[model samples]
Target: MPASLALSPTPAPARGRLWRTLRQWWAVLLFGAVAAVYALSPSSHDARSRNATARLLHATSWQALPWFALLSALISLALIRTLVVTAQSYGLSQFALEMVVRVLLLELVPLGAALFLLLRVALAGDLLPQADPAGGLAPHALAAERWRLELLPRVLALGFAVLALATASGVLALLLAYTVVYGVTPWGLDSYTRMVGRVFDPAVCLALGLKTGLFAVAVAVVPLASALQEPYAAARRAAGFAVRSGTRRVLAVLVLLQAASLALKFL
Candidate 1:
């Protein structure tokens, strides 16, 4: 009787674990499919593709627009002010705007947006829900639903969000720099536009877009992958382990993307 009772629960746990594994794997496969389609599709003007793109753009832009714009503006202003003061201190005030654009827009904005999404959307909502004790679903079902509904949208959204924020913030930074340098006049627009047109060559634009997309994927996909890799029973305890693993994965992706972008630029 005692042996049978012990063995009974063992089967249930095993069954639960197998189902959970299947669900996790399915999620990974789905993610791969989505990513492939996204990458391979040409820039399209056809209604279907355009609508899909617009939907993605809208979701990413509209969902977080107000907050992201505000944050970017504040950060840009603070950084510009600091750079201006530093440059003035060194008697190089003329170089401040150029420095701000190159550093803040070309580099920091996309990376910051990626990290922000990872924290706000990916970590706080997506992963946390997967580990929720009272979610009231079985482990496998919960994992599947989380991946399908939460993770997929987040990965897609973050990718688009980063792009939107980068483009929007880049323009804003340029404008802010102009106002600082030229004191709110149209006189600087021609020079500023020329600089932008020169900087945004085909290669640089492509690289920027690719890097932003990869960052989004890294932010959204890695954490879920890590969480899925954990044992269902130990999920809560394993959350930290998963997070560390995900961080490493995200870093690897970032380094590889950066290296690839640099290599492409040079070659």
Candidate 2:
């Protein structure tokens, strides 16, 4: 009896191990999907791609305006004040406004918006399903339609959210920086516009726009892909791993953006 029992093939353990392995690959698959989208982005002239681009812009800008404005204003005030004080201390006040535009507007705001959306929207998606007792769809179906429609859309929305916030904040910060430096006066407009025009050359503008779009896509696509790649049996074990995988995906996207921007600038 003991021999017969021992000889019995326990399929459960084998199945569990297979599930675990698949869960691990889910993260990898998510990263690949984001990369693929970037590579296969609809042509600039393609009507469908154009519409998608327009939708992304509208969603990010109009839908996310209020929250973005509030956050951007708070951050701008803190940064401007610090820059003003620091510049005065060093007798480098002349350079302060330029620095604010270059640092806060050009670099930080966009990245911050992306990160904020990742936390606010992307993380929430992960936690929401877990919190729902009757919440989750069956694993296979969830992997198919749900991921493409529900998860991808939210992620895409987040990308838009970040882009809209960044563009609005960058513009606002420019206005605020001028007021802080030159006071409320019409004379400053010419100088401000010149600086804006110089800073926003055609290439730089294109790069910035592309970067914002990419950031949005990265924030949305990676996490959902990770979750879907896992085997059904390992769903519970896969959750934490999937989040981590998503984070890595975000980081990779950021790095690639920076590299691309640099290459564009130099080349």
Candidate 3:
């Protein structure tokens, strides 16, 4: 056979790409393990990390408060008003608050918070470095330092921000819901408590707690795991493919978790 007809040698780059793909999967699993460990005692992280995280948390939540608060207020009011008005039109005004609580506070707020944080983190880009076997002790120290000072703080801060924003917005939305339904009157207090209590039963409360916590965790972990924790060579060779694939995989996991929660509640 002619030399050209002989099977072309597998290019070094192709082999490298394949190997990088394998390592990416391993990194994903490791991310899950690390994220789980981090979540269990987020309050116990180091002081330096906490300080850095505080700054990030501020950026993620406090700095953006006016816009988020305003947007949430507007949307909540629009939704609550629509529900209340429609309920009254249909002679179901008594159940309007319950509908608002379940739909807005429990469902939309957590999801909207997750998407907002995800978009923010994606724009910030990845800051992690892949472990190099030949890089010796100094490199390991650098990775550890990076993880502690830069990476961990960002991850934790973003997570906490997700929680904070969802919670703050949720509370605000609740207040708006009440005002829209009852016109800020003192007499509605007892009625409000009874309705809220009925809507937020033990099972519902547990589900909302779990869903919000998971949303926070997902927004924090997915972007970091997708971009960081991969070798420079591999990343350079296929940056777009790596990013798109990793991001979709992480997102798929998040969607599955959300689906599981729905199933728990309804199925």
Candidate 4:
């Protein structure tokens, strides 16, 4: 291969692909920044916005917490029991606690929380009301108003739901794992805490936290981005297609994030 040829200007196709990728990510980042600013602005703390946020938060988190906790506890118990039996039979009993922490607490809880919030929001379609910009405001102003009054609160609510559910269910799973693996006694508390601490070292903890935040952001942002991509007329005309495509986008982002997390943790 000639040096000149190798060092020559990049091909058009490659440059085009790179440009497209940059453009896509830039849009996502820009949207996130605008949303964040709106969410944090003092004007957003108005009574109406606060009330909307609180109501949505209650519906998203409180309403789902009990059922989610019950389901997580049952599943955790079954898995813990099975893991204990299997480990004891296979002479790996000592590693059961670590396995539960890694698999159940770090992985399952966050993913399940994100999925639950996604499903709940999907089922309760159009959680945000359409805001009408008064006094013949410009398109940009109307969009800003909508983001502040309508989208920001719902996204905040759903994001809160994801974190709340993940935290609550994760704690419950840990307790259940301990109870099932070591009985209802305080004797194993030290060993259990040590193992959990070991499993959740700085690197693992960082990855888990990042993965959870990414999951929440993906769950909250993808649908909104997809909805915005469609013009009002087209969205109204092909609502089902818009929904199906949005779901696919959300799932793709989630799977990608999960794969990256696993790679970071184990690779």
The candidate maximizing TM-score is 4
Candidate 4 TM-score, C-alpha based = 0.82
Clash list (residue pairs), candidate 2: 60-160, 155-220, 159-216
TM-score of each: 0.65, 0.65, 0.77, 0.82
**Candidate 2 lDDT tens digits, 4-24:** 787747688898998865664
Clashing pairs in 4: none
Q: Which 10-residue window in model 4 sums to the lowest lDDT?
A: 130-139
The C-alpha local distance difference test score for the whole of candidate 1 amounts to 0.65
Worst 10 residues of 2 by lDDT: 127-136
Candidate 4 off by > 4 Å: 1-29, 128-142, 234-237
Q: Compute the lDDT for candidate 4.
A: 0.76
Model 1 residue runs over 4 Å out of place are: 1-63, 88-94, 127-151, 259-267
lDDT of each: 0.65, 0.65, 0.72, 0.76
Cα RMSD, each candidate: 9.7, 8.6, 5.7, 5.6
Query: Once all C-alphas are superposed, what RMSD does model 2 give against the true structure?
Result: 8.6
Error of 4 at 30 (Å): 3.5
Question: Which residue pairs does candidate 3 place in steric collision?
Answer: none
